[model samples]
Structure formats: C-alpha cells, structure tokens
Target: MSFIESHLGDARQRRRLITGIRESLRELGLHLSLLNRQVSSRLELKDIDVDCLDLIDRHGPISPSALARSAGLHPATLTGILDRLERGGWVARERDPSDRRAVLVQALRTRNSELYGLYAGMSTSMNQICDGYSDAELQVIADFLTRSAQAGRAAADDLTSG
Candidate 1:
C-alpha cells in the first residue's frame, strides 16, 4: 500500500477501536448496575441504601453532611437511608470524639465480611481477566478506567449544576 493510504487505514482503525471501547464501557455499566441490583435485593436493601453503604465503607466515619455531599443526596433523604442501614446492622451513627456535638456514620465491620463475600465472585472473575494481561497492559487499563470515571463524574456535576 502507499504510505498515505496506510496512514489513512490506521486512522480509520483507531476510530473503530475508540467506538468499540465506548460501547464496551456502556455495556459494562449496565451489567454493573444489574449486579448491584441483584446484590441489593439479596440483602433486602434498596439500591440507594447499598450505594450509601459502599460510600460509608470507603469514607467513614464521615459526618452526615460530608457524606451527603459525596453522595449527592439531600440530607433528609440520607437520614432515611441511614436509618434503614442502621436497622439492617450495616452501619451506625456515633458521636465524633473530636467534636461532641457532631455525629459520624460508619460501616459496621461485623457485616463487612458478608458484603465482601457477596462480591467475591466478581473479584475472582476480574482477577482471571487480569491474568490475561501483562502488568503494563493492566496499568494502562487501570489508568483508562480511573480517568473515565473522573470524566463521568465531571460530566454529571456539570449536568447537575445546569
């Protein structure tokens, strides 16, 4: 092939690959939402409740206002979600020692193992998939996913702000 023709083919191939990646991401998001819904149903928890639990597990003991900001939930709605989580023994609201008048929400460690167990299958599957990639390839994939998530968050924030 001519040099210019070869370069044109490469450009077309790059566009196709980018399109495939975008579709794959969209499908992956739908599958993840399905998985989350299944796990939430198994635990007898609402989807939002499970989401709040994850945030708390990651960032607790966090104050309710901070949690609300992180979650993009209204404080009153978060209160109800917290109530359900507390009743389910998934989390607790306790006084912050550093500030007597404030309360912090924390995930209860007792139920953490159970939650982890529910996700163990996915972890194993992801590990098996990662086994096919070299470390450098895995790092690139991780970086891409992290950047994609950040971009999604930024886009969501823009939508909400407008």
Candidate 2:
C-alpha cells in the first residue's frame, strides 16, 4: 500500500486527526475569548487598553505619539484609545512638565493598583497551567509556538505588503 494509505489505512485515523484539529482550534478560540471577557470584566478594560496601561506602567508616563509608535497603532487610533481611557478615569492626559507642547498620558493611581492585581492573578494562573510540564517540555513548546507565530506574521506581512 502507498505511504498515505498505510498510515491512514482505515477511515478512523483520518477522522480522528481531523476531529482533533477541529477541537483544538475551537478550544483555542474559546479560551482566548473567555480570557478576554474575564479580564475586561475584572478590570473594565479592553485588550489594547490593558496593553497601553501595561506599557505605561513599565515605561513611565509617555506622550501619545510615543505610545502609538510602541503599540503599532496610528496616532489617531491611539487618540481614541486615550480618550476612552481618560473618560473612564483610568488615565489622564496632562501637559508635560518639561514640554508644554506635549501632553503626557498617565494611569491613575487607583486604576494602576487594580491593573497590577489583575496581572498578578493572571500570572499565577498561567504559572499553574505550566506546573505539570517539565522545563524542557515548556521550552520546546515555547520555541515551537514562537516559530509558528513568526511564520504566521511573515505570511500576513507578505499579503499586506504585496
């Protein structure tokens, strides 16, 4: 028999692989959606908003132009995000003490604490998920996934830049 026929000699093996792939895709989609919902519910922030917050928390206060560059978003898009965040009282835009022409976007103290707590909780849960894996297994998985992501990004870039 041919290699393909020998390996998938019966219909059952092919069916099982197809089913496994489908289930994995569904589970991944559901997991990401659920994680997004949980985070939004707990912190009253969307993914991009939280990303901006995290960036500010790490890099200190920054101007909207700098934030847009770092976040790979347009200045106009970042302005809208900043507007929503400012309106929610999570962040504020103030005139830069050193540069009167530039406004610095900063997180409010109370919201900063809230975001930190949520981050800590998520980190703990993620650590727990990897608890059962060996260091080598974790490294392999991480490497594989990183490569997969890079490949996907390259494909997208090709399509967009073409």
Candidate 3:
C-alpha cells in the first residue's frame, strides 16, 4: 500500500492528509518564488526575466511567440525581457535555419556556468532528498508533482481566459 493509503484509516484522516498536501504545495510555491527572486537579484535581473531565460534555455531555438506563451506574458512584454537578456549576453536572437524569415532566441553558454553554480546547492539538496526514496516511490512522487503542475497551468488558463 502507498504511505498515504496505509495511513488513511478514516475519512477524517484522508481529509487531513489532503489538507496537508494542499498546504505543502502552497508553501513550496512561496518558497520557490522567494528563491527565484533571490537568484534573479544576484544576476541583476527581475524574477520574470530569469524565468523567461530559463524557458528559452530549455526550449531553444524557440520563437518569441512560443516563449511568450510559455511564460504567460504578452508578446510586447516578452520583447522587453528578450532585449534585456540579449543585452546581458544571456541569450541571442538568430535567424531560424529552417525558416530564414523567422527569428529564434537561444541561451548563450557564456553565463550558463554562473547560473548553474547558483543552483548547485539546491540541486545537491534535492538529490540527497531523492536518494531516500525507492524507484517506485520516486515515480509516484514525480507523477504527482507533474499532475499538480498541469492542474496549476489549467487553472491559470481558466483564470486568464475568463
């Protein structure tokens, strides 16, 4: 049985566990936001700028339209972020090889080491925490977190659309 399933003997216990999960997710989001803010400040960037750069790094050579969609910002706002990133040597705007008329934004390797260095401590801590979990347990945790992120994205979409 799963840890939660094994402990859920009654409806009250289940409700309490669910509430705990909800609260934990909220706390995690707040902590992550604060961590991003600290990292951005160290990089002399805004939190959203770092977030956009991360998206670009992960999805390059991606178009500005796609980056704007992923970042949930309007195209105009994304232009400003892209400009800053380009100026800081964090990213480059290049003509798409497949579509010469199109432009793609890609992360530059110049500051990538610095960015990774800032995240090394957190990466180490998370790896240590993951080491305690069995493969099956880790899979379940990953599935849950992935679903939670999807739910958050859907909820955000709903809010924005309405």
Which candidate number would show the highest TM-score if scored against the true structure?
Answer: 1
Q: Candidate 2 residues 23-134, lDDT tens each?
A: 8867976886677667777777777887787677676588888888667678998888888788888888899999898899887787666656756866788789899899
* Decoy 1 TM-score against native: 0.95
Model 3 stretches with alpha carbons more than 4 Å out: 1-9
| Tens-digit lDDT string for candidate 3 (16-130) | 9999999999998998899889899999998999999999888888999999888888999999999999999999999999999999999999998999988898889999999
Look at candidate 1 and give me any clashing residue pairs.
Answer: none
Compare candidates 2 and 3 on TM-score and give the better one. Answer: 3
TM-scores for the candidates: 0.95, 0.57, 0.92
* Candidate 2 stretches greater than 4 Å from native: 1-26, 54-72, 87-113, 116-122, 152-162
Question: How do the candidates rank by TM-score, highest first?
Answer: 1, 3, 2
Candidate 1 lDDT at 53 equals 94
| CA error at residue 137 for candidate 2, angstroms | 0.7
For every candidate in turn, the CA RMSD to the true structure comes to: 1.1, 5.0, 3.9
Clashes of 1: 0
lDDT of all the models against the reference?
A: 0.93, 0.78, 0.92
> Lowest-lDDT window of 10 residues in candidate 1?
153-162
